[model samples]
Target chain A: MAEFFTNPLVQSVLVPVAGGFILTGAIRFANGRAKGPLVAGAAVALGFLVGYVLIVGLPPLPPVSNQQKLAYVVAGGLIIGFLMDFSRRPPFYRELVYIVGAAAALYWMALPKIAGGTAWTYLSLVALWIAAGLIGYRLEKSRANVVNACAPLLVAALGLGLVALFGRTGSYSQLAFSLATAFGGFMLWNWPIARYPFGATLLLGGAGALVTIAYALALYTEASPYALAMLLLCFFAEPVARRIKLPAGKIGEAFRPVAVGAVALIPALAAVAVAYLTAPGQEAGY
Target chain B: MRTRSIIAGAAALMASTALIGTASAADNYKIDATHTNIIFIVDHLGFSNMIGQFQSFEGNFSFDGKSVEGASVKLTIKTASVDTDHEARDKHLSSPDFFNVQEFPEMSFTSTKFEATGDKTAKMTGDLTMLGVTKPVTLDVTFNKADKFPMDPNVFIAGFSAKGTVNRQDFGMKYAAGAIGDNIGLWIEAEGHKQ
Candidate 1:
């Protein structure tokens, strides 16, 4: 816990989540939707969590051969956009059931190996991202919202782009870039939505970004075998904290997931670097 | 007429066999360091594989068609010449994990048995010493071609390639289990001239 508090990545992740919540809260309190800030905060937090889990926990995915990783990025952006359009309204059993089932399906579809260090893996990732966007569109239809639909698709695209590019290189870089991109997108999108209901698109893009980044990080880097656990910690943190009645901006509230991401990122990168340095049998064959 | 044809065919077979035996006769040859190559490769990560080759070495081999039954082959690879572009890694390869130049300086492979499998191929079993561990390995030997040297016509060139795999652990090299695989594949292409 002490180490977590002192880490740079943890510091980086929490600053925005807590600060954004406060800013959104102030804006909502003034606009008479005192709950608006809370809603936006929840969406941001949720996006971050889902993204972190998918990237860090998974195995090295198969690479797409025909196209580059851009395909995955575009697909992810579109999904988040679609989802942002949907997730609004009173709690309904049918929608909830569909979301749960869709998430499970996405997880299953993502299990095939995609990291072949070829263009194919990137292309497949893009296709999957786009499919997720379509699912987001369905989720938005239930809520009858436009801004929310766009948010998820946009965020998914951005997140997928980060993963495809930075994730191609290293684990720590993936986590760092993913968190940075998703958080930034959320902050920018939250401003307009807190004043008005932009719909499921916001959540879709935000969450999609996080998910794609996390998945890309996991696929490319040997950062953590338990990336899913870290992501879950992120995803469930707000709800869990709310259950215990911790204030939105409290230190311990969002600290857990950030701490986990940091812990996984650093050591994994060091080990990889060490292996590269100490590699033996220096002879090339013809 | 049948008896005459049978005798002629037998005579032709004898003549051809004798001509081939003389023409393809083996002689003692020195492995020209300038032309020979020694290389090995392994998976760098799940991502890509890497290879390295020794640029220099000296060895000599010799045999005769009359003494193909007792043919012998030998090679001595310089422990220091291990190159994979990285200096630090090359040193480690020559260390205890590989050649271990301090303890056992030069790696040598000497054949104990040679069996001609066909017209241009043979199987040579030999003991290879590396890191002070000696193990028997068989070479899939192929006699590529033989010709008089362009520079020195008196000297003939006999090209041969021997390939085999040796477990690095069998030679007392066991480090980097998950990172670096165990099996060390080896290839030797040596040219020999009548010495």
Candidate 2:
């Protein structure tokens, strides 16, 4: 029983999902509308924080490794997201926060790499920040919609997990899966009925987690950028789901998240396929 | 008598000059990468030990064979060059879980001290930096011999073999932990040519 609990899958994936589900459920059950949604925003972040701590733990004061830097970046993004949820801020305000937050994190993270004065490296840094930052900004904007928020991002997370796995980076794969399962837990509340607000907290955390996971894999592992690019098409999940016609009853209401999920799974599966087909050919060592 | 005293003073002056010329200076040598090997070993599931090697490296050392205390060595190994006869495993090793070659491409070592334990054996203490973490390591080094190379008599060569064990976890290489074994045994065989 102890061994079972200590297993990597249980510790990394199950524990975080449980944490998110329980906390969000608690907030929905007891709290009134006063500041419930704002507090509720913290549930997914809490889940991710759990998994992050369990997997990578806390980094040293002066983070030396890339993973350590990643830990700090994710924390900063979530805090910014929480601040966003504290107010019904204008879209420009949100955009400004996202832009500045992304820029600051990228600057801190890419300092050493671009400090070498390689023009190409600097350009790549800019490109990485733009791509990752855009996904995060858009994903946060999608908090109110089901097709774009939890369900579709869930599919995207699963796809990223598979890509990381086949790319031979177990850490990134585990992180992606942890985020995917956390989204799944949170979806339990919203799927049958909307009991809680999906604000910047959950969406931003979800988006930031997915984006950073992909970014790390792209930079560190042999994962195909083409595969990641295919996964990027997940942004179209909500738009695609918007076009679908639904039945006129409770059945449609429950099936809505599922239907959107099915739509999102296409790009995800395509990403996985590309990852597998393009994986570096190598013999697995025993 | 005066002539004898003057000749003795001149002889003393010559002796001092010869002593100054014989003062020990460290001899510099370029590490012969072609003739050197850096090998590592780790336990595999408690059933066996898996051995691996790094293919690319460059280094040099200064050693006065008579004075082991004055010897110093520096080496840099390309972490991406790690090989274990399995390509996938090598890729895994290069990932963040192990060497993180993308973020930290090179592992280096520079000796801080050398303690002679015997006529031909000494311990070399140095800071080994890997995965962006540095730890002091002491290797049991044996100076095998120093002489002219058999193939090229014009080149003077010094040969040595060193072995050490390091906890990869100490360097933040927290991968499979116990299952993969933390204590990685390192074996280095090097021959340096005097330069």
Candidate 3:
């Protein structure tokens, strides 16, 4: 029992879930507006803050590059807030905002690689972020917060697996855990009848987390390209689920997230298989 | 008697000149990267010690036999160059939990003081900066030898070996503290050529 509690996986899952619940409950109580864009925006902001605090305190933080990535996360949140405010605006105006938001997120997501003078890497990361953001946006539009939130959770699980397989720990892994926990917390409010929409939060947070995971794998881990390809492919789950027909009412509602999750799992499992088979030796060379 | 006095005075002048030359023998040297190595050791779950090293580094030093304070050394290591024999482990070491190589790509040490403890050894104090955190550390350094390279006499070489221990927590590396040892031992063997 002590060992279980001490386990990083447990801490990663439990802390954020508890924090998310507390934060969401507090916001609901304070504002008395359980539904709408404002509540959703507030929930996203609080969830991220709480999750960040629980995972990594400000004092002994990760590297500056990872730290700078937070700015992108905040920028993503702000974009969502803007979208929520102008939701009733003309379609053209909303589309413009999304375009600008995507561009900004892509730039910030690829900033480290860009600064490192790896143009190809930067371009590839931008493409991946755009794809992820689109998938998340489409899912949110379909009123499927559960599916949107689950994307990050899946990616986080993969990161944790990678850590265990390699027997190494780092900030990327910690961030992955935080992301998973945050989404887990978000899920409680998101299920049955969502207290608030998690569209923007999922898009921004998911993209940010995925980008970090990809970079960590590419730069540090000996994970095969196929593994990374599978990870990226998981983002298509939302689009695929949109095509599925299901029974109406609560059954369909619950089934929607499950369907999306199943689609994602296919690629995720494949990535794991590739990684396990091609795993490198435990020795490092200078 | 007058001739004897002149001979003694010449001899004294020669002796003074030789002493002055020895006092000013402090030579500046550039690090010979090919021959210098920066190695480290950390405890792994109390099972065994895990040894590692950095592949890319550069350093320089000024050796002064006359005054220990005149001696100074500086080294800069690429944090991403860390190797523990495993690609995955090395990658993890360079990740944000430890070096955060993407952000703080370089770790450096600059000597602040050198106290001669014996004819061939000294205590060197320096500031080691990693992950944007700087801390003062002392290394027990031993001068192995100084001579012209056998292959290339034109290049004068100086060799030194140093050992130190630093608490990883001090540099903000507090991940898996109980599982991995906090204190990391550093062992460096360096060779520099006179510039």
Best TM-score goes to which candidate?
2
lDDT of each: 0.49, 0.77, 0.65
Candidate 1 residues lying further than 4 Å off, grouped into runs, are: A1-286, B1-26, B65-68
Question: Model 3, range A141-209, lDDT digits (tens) per residue?
Answer: 544465454653555355444543443444445555655566656566766555465444444444444
Better of 2 and 3 by lDDT: 2
Clashes per model (N, Cα, C within 3 A): 80, 0, 6
lDDT of 2 by residue, B119-179 (tens): 9999999999998889999999999889998898999999899999999988988766557
TM-score of 1: 0.36
Ranking by DockQ: 2, 3, 1
Q: Which candidate leads the pack in lDDT? A: 2
Query: How does each model score on TM-score?
Result: 0.36, 0.90, 0.77
Q: Model 3, residue B123: displacement in angstroms?
A: 2.9
Tens-place lDDT per residue, model 1, A54-119, is 333221133221012322442444354343333444434333533443354344334444323368
Q: Per-residue lDDT of A1-286 in model 2, one digit per residue for the tens?
A: 7456436687568987897788776765455576675546466667777776666666776898767777776677677666776666555665666666666766665555655658777776677778766665556656565434678678888899898877888777877888888777777767687656656555456566677677677667888788887887776676577678888787776776677788889998999998887776533422
TM-score ranking from best candidate downward: 2, 3, 1
Error of 3 at A157 (Å): 6.1
Task: Give me candidate 1's interface root-mean-square deviation.
Answer: 17.7
DockQ of each: 0.02, 0.48, 0.27
